[model samples]
Target: MSVKSIVAIVVSLIILVAGVSSVYVVDEREQAIVVKFGEPKRTVTTPGLHFKIPVMEQVIFLEKRILSLDVPPQEVLASDQRRILVDSFARYRIADPLKRYQAARTEVGAARLLEDAMESTVRQVLAKEPMNEIVSGQRAELMKKISDLTNQRALTFGLEVVDVRLKRVDLPRENSEAIFRRMETERQREAAEKRASGQRDAVKIRAAADRQVAEILAEAERQSQTIRGEADGQAVKIFADAYGRDEDFFEFYRTMQAYRKSLGKDDTRLVLSPDSEFFKLFMDNK
Candidate 1:
């Protein structure tokens, strides 16, 4: 090849390289800023082919997509003076490319600043509420406050805060253990009190039952004694009438009853003279 042909070919390649470097494309998911000599010149949000001065102007592409950031868990103090472990996250987007580039050189840098803002905002907002509120249904309100504050702060970095969420909010391990133990102790105490009350009620019921049984038995015995006394009186009247009708027969009948009573048992024995009055009736019969 000729030397002139080689020189012309080299110049054409250099021109092509410079032209390609001067033009850059921005896509739907990207926003860009053109910086000349380390100074941002213009911000471009429209997605299309763009131009810049080769070797002097540089295009910094910033993501237009919603970015997610997970913040580290932090121990924060609640208004109730309770310590809580809170882990959170947020979604954001680059609203102004030029401001974003000027404020943070890279996405990583922006994320760091946003994370700090998120932590500070969350802590401040939570500090105004008690732990119960933060852990309960009212937590949604507190999170909104944090999100608003974070959005306001994020505006300075040309970032739009979309949403801030609490991934997990709970008591520290030590606090959790202490609370659980206390709850268990309280339940146990309540159970013991209930058992004692039941025992007292049972004792009262048993005593009442025993008293009722004793009254019933005493009344029954009184009725039985009354009936027996009435029978004895009736028997004595009949005996008097019989004795008036036939004194000798009645005397024999009474003596026979006495003999039966005396010898009712097989072991019966008596020491008496054959002519004794106790045996007079028996000797006459014999």
Candidate 2:
């Protein structure tokens, strides 16, 4: 080969290598940290083709996506000296790539730092709360406090904590069993009381109803007797008035009825004058 041609080929090869090394593409969901010899140079937030000094600088890409870290369950003692198992989780985002690279340098390292800070914050906050507050209604407030404290500490490491939440707060197995037994006992007692109260109420209502029924029947019987007595009196007065209009006929009829009622087949003998008043009826009939 000619000397001029050899020189042109070598320059072309060097130019190709340098061109290949100078350009990099940052993805849409990623941020790049430019480091020169173990020292951060600049951070690139925009996503596009970027330029760097060939072979002299390095580009470190970090995910800008939201992240979730599930903290393992830990036993915490509350202010009431109650031991509880607390399982929590957190959400975070990488806000500053350069700061994140300097502090943690990897996602795993950042997660570990977050876990440590969360553990401390949880312990410090929960240690002041009562067991009931930790397990029941005050969980949201406590989680907010933990998130605020963790975020304040994590700012230096370029992590923005969005929220912290507790998955569960459980008592130990033995304590849980005891609580359940107590709850069951209380429920049974309440149920028994309710049943007894219902029975008493039913008995009272039934007795009242029975008394009312008896009073009604008694009133009905009294009214019936009064009506029957009034009817009998009115009938007797009517019969007396009717019989007064025909005294002679009434006397004759009464005499005949009395004879018929007193006479019997077994009475064979009698002593009486033929013209006596007692024989008047028989003589008239003959």
Candidate 3:
């Protein structure tokens, strides 16, 4: 080969290598950190082709996408000396790549630091709370406090904590069993008391109803007796007036009615004189 051609080929090869090393494509969801000899030089936030010194500068790409970190279940003791298991998660983003790179070189390291800070915050917050507050009802407030504290701690690391949430807060298995048993016992006792109260109310209502019914029946009976007595008195007065007009006929009629009522189908014998007043009805035709 000619000397000029050899020189041109070597220059072309060097240019190709430098071009390959200098050019970097920043993705839409990523930010690039330009570092010269392990020291941060600049940060590129825009997405496009970027350039740097061919041999000395390096580009470190960081994800700009929202991230989630799940903290493992941790046991914490409350102010009441009750142990609880808490499982939680966090959402965050990288706001400053330079600070993030300086503090946490890798995503793993950032996550670890966040976890440690979360653990400390959880312990500190829970240590002043009662068991019930930790296990129920106050989870939202606790999560907010954790997120705030975590955000404050992560500020130096260029991390923005968006949210922190507790998946579950529960008593240990043995404690849970005890609490369940107590709840069951309380419910049963309340049910029994309510049942007893219902029975008492039922008895009182029945007694009141019965008293009203008895009073109604007694009042009806008294009115019926009064009406019957008035009728009897009117009948007696009518009979007395009739008898006064015809004494002989009324006496004969009364004697006949008495004989009919006194005799029975099973009677074997009846004795009476032919001319007696009691036999007058039977002897009248004869």
Index of the highest-lDDT prediction: 1
Per-residue lDDT, model 2, residue 120, is 93
lDDT of 3 by residue, 1-286 (tens): 9999999999999999999999999999999899999999999999999899998999999999989999999999999999998888899999889999999999999889888888888888888899887776587888888899989998789888999988888888898899999999999999999999999999999999999999999999999999999999999999999999999999987887787776745664668677886776666574
List residue ranges in candidate 1 displaced over 4 A. 238-252, 276-286
**What is the lDDT for 77 in model 2?**
91
Instruction: Please provide, for model 2 over 34-149, each residue's C-alpha lDDT reduced to its tens digit, 9 standing for 90 to 100.
Output: 99987999999899999999989999999888899999999889999999989999999998887889899789998999899999999999999999888886788999999999
Q: After superposition, how far is residue 256 of candidate 3 from its true place, in Å?
A: 2.4
Reference-based lDDT, each prediction: 0.92, 0.91, 0.90
Report residue 11 deviation for candidate 1 (angstroms).
1.8
* The candidate that achieves the highest TM-score relative to the unseen native structure: 1
lDDT at position 177, candidate 2: 91
User: What are the clashing pairs of model 1?
Assistant: none
Pitting candidate 1 against candidate 2, the one with the higher lDDT is 1
- Model 2 clash pairs are none
lDDT of 3: 0.90
User: Model 1, poorest ten-residue lDDT window?
Assistant: 277-286
Model 3, TM vs. native: 0.74
Question: Candidate 3, after superposition: displacement of residue 113 in Å?
Answer: 1.3
- Name model 2 segments beyond 4 Å from true: 2-12, 27-29, 36-56, 70-88, 130-143, 165-184, 223-247, 252-286
| TM-score: model 1 vs. ground truth | 0.86
